[model samples]
Target: MTGAPRIALITGATQGLGLALAEGLAQRLAPDDTVYLTGRDLDRVNHAVESLPGGGARVRGELLDVADPHAAGRLAGRLAARHGGVDVVFGNAVMRVGPDDDPREIVTEYAEVNNFGTTRLLRAFAPLLRDGGRLVVVASSLGTLHYLAPILHDRFDGATSLDEVDAQVAAWRDAVADGSARGGPWPGFVNIPSKIGQVAAVRAFARERRGHDLAHGVLVAAVCPGMMNTPTSAEWWDVRGAPGPAEAAVPLLDLALGPVDPLHYGRLVRNGKVLPWSPYRDDSA
Candidate 1:
């Protein structure tokens, strides 16, 4: 609380987990710290900010549609001019499709937001990270290697650049379009690969920052907050008794604002632990 004021940004923060994250940060950060809660809708964004504790004094609302292709960069540029640099960023915007959704449609929609938008956010905000800043991509356990076919394991695990990860995503889209992806190799749940691409992007980005000269060095990771009983989750699965967004925000806030761990860098983390990249590992625990 005695350190310099911090600047944090949370995408898709109008509601659900993103909103909860914004609220948690607003409450935990120093009084002077600024937390930007962003969403595609200007009205909702404003409403979300106005609803936070402290009369939303430290929280600001911004319009951000991750799918816009240029929105992230624009926001980052404006933030850079005002704050010089950012301390933490949560790439929390995403799109989810249900089981009954068309495979081709799912690929198109998820790629725009969940997959490509993730890469866009990283590319724009990463350079603005302060010395010890953290960039967290809100991925899921379904993104783990174990959920993907063995054929794709090496491709995702060995990817060292965003372009490489993108190639895999493009391939999946093509497979879905041609009707060859209907069976085993890829999971029936199309969203799995989108999340995989997200985690892969995090690992790839982390590797790129290996030798940078920063105070504590920047930490980037893909985090799975687990299932929450939010409207988004309720849309796909029966999360009747699942934890709420506020409960799920605890670990995410810890990972973002707590001490930085080099081991957690560039890895998939959940509940404060790093998830294995190997598909064969028993990750159920």
Candidate 2:
């Protein structure tokens, strides 16, 4: 926005990988360019903004809850008013309803944050994105089932609003709604269906938004930030432990702000490899 060549907004930029990303980006960006760091906690956001290493890129803080229905549009308007428009919008912030939360609750959480929070921002900000601009979604490897088995596409790909996600969940509401997403899970696998659904949503967004093709004309890619050390997954893996968010931010950074092509939209990519999450890997072992 503001006729600038580059301006970025990273949500959930306070702690964990998000903070690391803000730090990393600050090191590389110029002083003129700004990176708006947002988070639910105002203190954390302020800290993130103030903590930006004195350098080329400037830092700003905003308190936001991605799960809020009105937050996305408000942010979009803020960007429009403050900076004319935006060139880069990274939809990285997400909050899960947790393992203990019922399926309905989880669906609600996902719809609130991931589906609505991120998707709505993407849609509202679509106007601000420069013609050749980049949009990076810091999804998880959990968003893909290729590494596990038996992938499935969401029947809800056409949904673009909360009403739609609710309707879709209602459809499953009547069914036996197995969180496993299939008859059962493969050994060492958890939440397979939800992950697959995420990938499907990314693909669906691309298909519906970009001529019903794959990875076309836009630099859209959903990266599986493999098992990062974050609280989101603590419900199941706490005992086993996991890599810290700082550690997992490497690949994520690449997916978000690194150099890439514009036609790779809707590509469920990892590192440089295209993961196989379709055709439903039947190996249940």
- Where's the lowest-lDDT run of ten residues in candidate 2? 181-190
Reference-based lDDT, each prediction: 0.85, 0.61
How do the residues 161-237 of candidate 1 rate in per-residue lDDT, one tens digit apiece? 99898888888877886778886487777778888889999888878885682345678889999989976688888
**lDDT (10s digit) by residue, model 2, range 42-104:** 988887788767886788888778888788789889888887776566677876555566654
TM-score of each: 0.92, 0.75
Where model 1 places Cα greater than 4 Å from the true spot, the runs are 55-57, 213-215, 280-285
The clash count for each model shown is 0, 6
Candidate 2 residue runs with Cα over 4 Å from true position: 1-5, 96-107, 145-193, 209-217, 231-235, 238-243, 280-285
Stretch of 10 with least lDDT, candidate 1: 276-285
Model 1 residue 29 lDDT score: 83
